[model samples]
Target chain A: MKLSTITKTILTTASLLCVNQFSAAALIPTHDSLVTVPVVSHQVERTSVHFSQPIAASQQLSSAIDSYTGISDEYWIEVSGKQLNQGIDLDVNHPQALIRLSAKQTKGAWLPDDHAIDPQDLSLFKNQRSIANAFSQKVTREQLATASIFPNSSAVKIAKKAGVGKFKLKVSKTLKSNQRYLINVKEKGSAYQQVLFSERQSYLAGQTITVRAAINYRERPLKNTKHMAFIKSPTGISQAIDYQTEQGKIRLAIPNDLPATKPGQLYELHISSQGRDGSSSIKRNGKVAFAVAQPTARMTGNVTANNQSAQIGLEVASEGRYEVSGIVFGYNKNKVLMPIMLSASAHYLQAGIQQVTLNFDPEILKSSSLIGPYQLRSLKLTDQSRMAVLHRNHVKQSNAITQLNK
Target chain B: MKKIVLSIMLCSVLLATPAMATQGLAFIHGTGNQTDAYSDYWTGSFVNSVRQGLNDPNKYTVINCDFDQFMWDSQAAGCLANQLTSFITNQNITELVLLTHSNGGNIVRWVLSNPTYDSRYPNIISKVSKVIAIAPSSLGTPLADAVNQGSVFETSLGWLLGYGSDAVSQQQVSWMNYYNQNWLHGTSGRPSLPVIFKTIVGSDVESAFWDGDSYCAGYQYQVALETTQNWLDSCSDGFLNCSSQTGAGTQWFIDKQRTRDSEPLSHQQSRRDCFNLDLIIKNDI
Candidate 1:
């Protein structure tokens, strides 16, 4: 759906209100009197993207080992796959592995005791070279039964220098005659780069999202890297997303014509990066999920406050249940604005302008010794039916309420 | 005159103390749309054993909702809210403890984190005293990724291993990271939740034919879990990595640390009455 001119006009009016009232003073008058306090409403611009697909049920796998056949001798299991600059760094990604070989009984039962493969019979190799000291000394029969394979410090050091490459686990010993075993490999640790999105969790369909990537556990930029990115829908459909990079930041716009997502499902942006730091190769994968919302309502920038409550105006586009939530900031005994209480209320409204009330507790005000010239901060309106965040205002100041009786 | 005086004294003693808080329990299943979770997901024995801690054992409900949808979906959290609210209101429960397994933790966490999401959510949050999550997939699992990967080799071989559902996709390693950072709470540097959320981590999977312990929750299930463990971290419960279980909430204890005789709890066993897990939870509540 395209952005309408009427929506633009509403957004412009809201923007003007923000510019005029955001800097208003939160000072309370020494004497109580009727006054006009500007309520700053930071209204979000709404788009016309609505998703209307029925939610799909989660799939369940019948079995996880339907493809593997019982093996009685040596076997090779690929630890990492060779893809386009996507080879994993063994040291950074998966440094240690627990390999267990369970004996398969004729009656389809798995026996941990009968298979007689020792820890010395297992070896890890990159391009078929034996890595010494790969297993720690704790791999007794008891440890093997539990599949606990701890990596030695020397082995970890050796893995750090192995760079980014495909790894394979090799079982050297043969099983007893007429016996078959099943192998299970488990690995851990990822020292890859960290990727994060800039604050907001939901965005308009046409809005841009910002992402930043840095080295593992450090804020340093991952420099001189090549990135491939894609956006995956809830239905497992993937589309390549074009991104612009500047100073280690990536920006991608949510396409207006993107397919509708199922209810409560989010779109994921996946990024795969590959680079070289000196002679060592680095590969990392990161993703972030966000909801793209269609605007169904906007705030009217009008508020009325009394001794006990405040009513905020909203302009609705359709009939549904909408919710308004905000934090109330009142002046303390020191005359500084501090958060006093948070209040939220929702109501069903027709397609027109309506108001929702935030009733402040008198006990709360009395206990905090709060005085007026109160302000509402972090005001938000959500379309509960659509499950979308419709609008947000950072701050809104209210008129002084006199005689908040205990 | 003596009999009347003794009766009056007994009545006075009863009225002196306030009424005890009505404690309630709920069992939330994971990853599927359950209609009869009491029998299908968590058997009757497990639920009954855990609910023995309640002041009124009858004050518990085994929630049967569609958890296969995303955590925030109407069928998921919306249904949960409805049932829990009914349970609280009908039973006059003042304090409620939630027992969640796997993705059930995420659904409950969604309600706690976003109190304003639904009109029913705030009330539910206020009533929840604590959440005892067992083998929670708080962080997504690598096994999910491998299953959803649907590599050409597996697809061509006609053994896709797993059904690629929205719930499975959501639990992928990267997807859970995204949800934790942006939507959920109680992770490191994220906002703390309104209620106490503690996790029980499952550390290993054992399927020995000779060992009776391996057959407690179904021997075949343990075999499948052992095979899937290959896709997880060494510190995994066959289905989820140990880090994933301890990802969102406070770590209550690992499997061997608290289970009967220090036996490890597999992913499936965590929901069953195996290894005296139910007794442990009963005492805690």
Candidate 2:
């Protein structure tokens, strides 16, 4: 039965207090056995393994073990189908089978808080049925006598066995939680090949992108397989490129063109590989995003150096930090000494045709060099974040700063 | 007694012939190939100014090598190596003092340290007496890393140094690290010749200004020093860090000197004054 708000609060408080009384090992599932999952049809090549007990997030396992075949708390399973003996591509967004979690309240800290179980706040489906949470009603523990069933049904039975229970069905989401409960995950088969982009962020116009694809096979490797990659722009522009294999993995380099669309546009990238024996054909599609960014604001200013402070006067577009960089050149003992690199930052809070003055000691830029008539050459103003050179000019004789030591 | 005195005079004249005289100094420009063989690279009439300062005409020779090629390119070092060989052979130079600035120091060191170059043109390596490197990029510059992955302004600055993208690519941090670790001192831990090497380091970086120091003193001024200083993390002359330019930990040199930008000099300016006629006259000669 559904607990009232007061009961939930009392239970929550009691659990927090009595949590230390229970064994830390008891919080984790003890059953270390796997059960076989029944498959649908003979035409499909499917393999499914089930953990008799739920796995906890904190449990440590060997990294050498695979998530599916070994003992990882997390696993990745791709769902694909056969068309004329060729494999279809599937990603996280579209899963053929669903993974659903069901929880029951047993004696002594039987279940973790619902918040811990579904930390992502996913919408819970009532009793693993199509009905949402609002329409579901509480059931007595005597009603769930037959809770364990194979793949389907028993949703209502499991809920009836536990007086307080909650369940959620998710597609393309990994089923993991701190709660100790029985979870059923049904997936159509594994993907034969996976293609991924080396860089996830958006690319710039006229840039080269690197793509990598790895083949996943349960049996023998594909012989004489040909792989190809293509990019289809938003304007329906398509181009096919050849790929080279390195250590049996396909690698392709895509040289993007000046983007036909505006900045921050998206395109479609597709890759397909087929074996000569006609037994394996894999195709994967991904979204390609790129942008052409503009430079930051331009700065117009002159800097003067004195004994106490170097005054910089400039007109800035935005109210942010700006870096003023220049080289200090002076004469020492009738010899033209070397130049030192100087840089300082100033923040302009006001925007739109604003003028600001930044003060810094001239000696910081002069750094043990003699003080005299010095010229600041290659003066550049740049935005701090974007590092865009807003203004660049040679101060020559006009941008002269002298340290009289006064 | 008159015949014996005449014999001594004849012997003294023979000993003072031109073939016995030692050739003087050679100046090599650093990275970006800023100096051509026909003109001064660092300062205005630098070759002539040094000659005048030393009050010597025929003793010193400046190698106006190509400045546009990548410093690591074999041709860049080969062209310099060829000039040193020809200068030594033609001048009947018995001993030579070498002065190099920036990347030029790297190339000269490569030619001297490499056994292959020493074997090919033995005179250039064997005839050298001392070397004075000013703000050399012996260990490479972090600015090169910035330039290779540079923004629009950084790229422009890199190009301004007479280095294109390809040349900037050669200056990446990994490449420079590898070059210093492997390319320098050749295959051996030390150079083949027992040459005495001196380094002039420029530490005029306004790093304090970045930290908002109140008493900002002793900064050397250059046109691009400020903009470029942000690109450098360590003590710098607005171009290269002091440690990289000086080969600090490599024990590659015999002695080292430092100049501050506040002292009215920078990487380029130090090269100018360091290789000046006064310095050559005082030390090399």
Candidate 3:
């Protein structure tokens, strides 16, 4: 059944309360049973057992176990359908097989691959996904449920029935209230399942707040496979929660609206996934930091001219930040110009290159309120799109500039 | 004593002379051919073409030095550095032709800039007759970030670095750091492109260049993740960027299919296209 807003808010509140919980099981959680996902279909050629799982944000995950296979196969398909049908005995050579939280959403992470990262490193939503992508390969879901943070602790370990796979975090004592929890993810070879991704969210016992985490691609919404915990103390100390919005954009959303939330606002950004592109974030020290959604205005546009010979233009390829200038003249635009090397002129797009470094040029094409758009040639046209983009990307003052006398 | 000294000087002169021989020509390597001799097929092909174009291999010893494709095999980068340092000292090296692949541009840049390499063979850098780069990593490639993740991810990300060398597995941190730290131009190091030297073909980015930072464009919100516009603006091919693509010469980015216009070529095809596009640069600029 669909959940009502009231229920969601309550659920959100409950999930918020779950942070600040810590478990002290120095032993890597060990599970009771085992589960192996088999390669489906009669086209069974060979399979590499994957032990995978999701690592919640603010959690650390890793593994030392090497590679092991269930059965020996005569041949292995190298790429999708292309195979090494030589009946060459295939073996799991290294300790590299495991399922992972691929992505919190259908979309992938900012970087192509992911890894187990420090919390501070997870501040960038993409970095969070990087850490998750790095760990999901070592452990699987089944392995986590039966495991434990402490020998008897359920925080790190998974229970037989993780309680309806409830979307909530279980906290511990080590964490102080209102502090953010940076989690990690890792894999366990000998487990109930082929792979398992896990997390351990814990914050202090001080001030606290709650928020929902989501993953997005373009504009489509995706699920948050994991949740981490943290605390924001009333002592003007707090962290931010990173999130993947409904649009697949990995965002570092800070609770700018919360009553007590401020720069010192502590937050734990919860992230999870089957491993494709699960999101996460970290701080400057390489620790995972929660992210707050920040939407800033970015300008995009072009520059153009009317004359036919030396047509020049510009475009802003960045956010609302820059300085632009060039000369047009007092009364009317008049002058001979040469092909400006974009890179040479910090403002220009340099030869055939674009993006790397930037420099805004003073208005090279002068305007005098007496002319049409600048022209590349007698017949050739020019605009920011076709011309060298730079200057005011979205905004240009005038188009009347004199063409260089060829 | 005078007789002995004269005899020694005469012997030295004799040893330095080659009978009825022409000057040694130059050989250039494609980008990132540093994995090893076998892994760099492009370099081998470049060697063959150079040999064929010149009609002599002995006169033009194409130094297939290690040019790590930015995978950060310190060993590979080091090996190339050491060997080239030696060649610069040992070989008479008549005319030098800097034929590089992707970041090979940076490799050559390093060679010419280093006093040990360039000073010993000042003529080599000066003789830099032509720079025929094959999809050189003039600009970095963002895709390279994946390569740094090591083995586990590589097992998952296969088709990534089409030119898979040991460097691909070498973490992404160093490569990024190297570009940010070292990549730059010198005053009199690399010879100016007197002749119309050219950069090869391919497309790299199309989707959302500027992703992590993006805005709505069409039905699906556009991403700054890796948009062509963004790449042209900030991101790079596995490693470098567009602004970095230019040098002290005439430059061009070819996309005959226009696919590169919208979607630039991934670092791999950018190389293969080098051969097909060879016809253009062979004679014309």
Best-fitting candidate, measured by DockQ? 1
DockQ for every prediction shown: 0.16, 0.01, 0.04
How far does residue A175 in candidate 3 sit from its true spot (Å)?
28
At residue B30, give the lDDT of candidate 2.
61
Candidate 3 C-alpha lDDT tens digits along A1-406: 1111111111111121132122220111111111121221211111111111111112111121111111110011111101111111111211222111221111132222222212122111121121122222122222221211001001122222221111222211122222211221211221211111112111112212223332223233334333332223222233345444432223332344533322212232323222112322211000122212111111121222222111122232222221222222121245322222111211212222122222212232231232322221111111111111111110011122222221
For candidate 1, the C-alpha RMSD (Å) to the true structure equals 13.2
Candidate 1 runs further than 4 Å off: A1-187, A190-200, A214-223, A277-282, A329-340, A363-375, A393-406, B89-94, B112-129, B138-163, B172-258, B261-264
Candidate 2 structure quality by residue, lDDT tens digits, B79-198: 777777778777777777787777777677666543232233345766887777766776555445333220111112113345533344334433344343323442122212236566
TM-score of each: 0.67, 0.36, 0.32
Across residues A1-406, which tens digit of lDDT does each residue of candidate 1 receive?
1111121112222443445343221111111111122221322112221111110111111111001111011111222111101322242334444444433332333333434456565566677676676554223343322221111100112234444345544445554444443333333344444454444446655667766644442434546777666777765567877789876567888876677865446777666656666555555555566677666676665555565565667777666666766555566677766565556566666676787775555565555555665554555576665656656543322222211221
Which has the better TM-score: candidate 2, or candidate 3? 2
Error of 1 at B49 (Å): 1.8
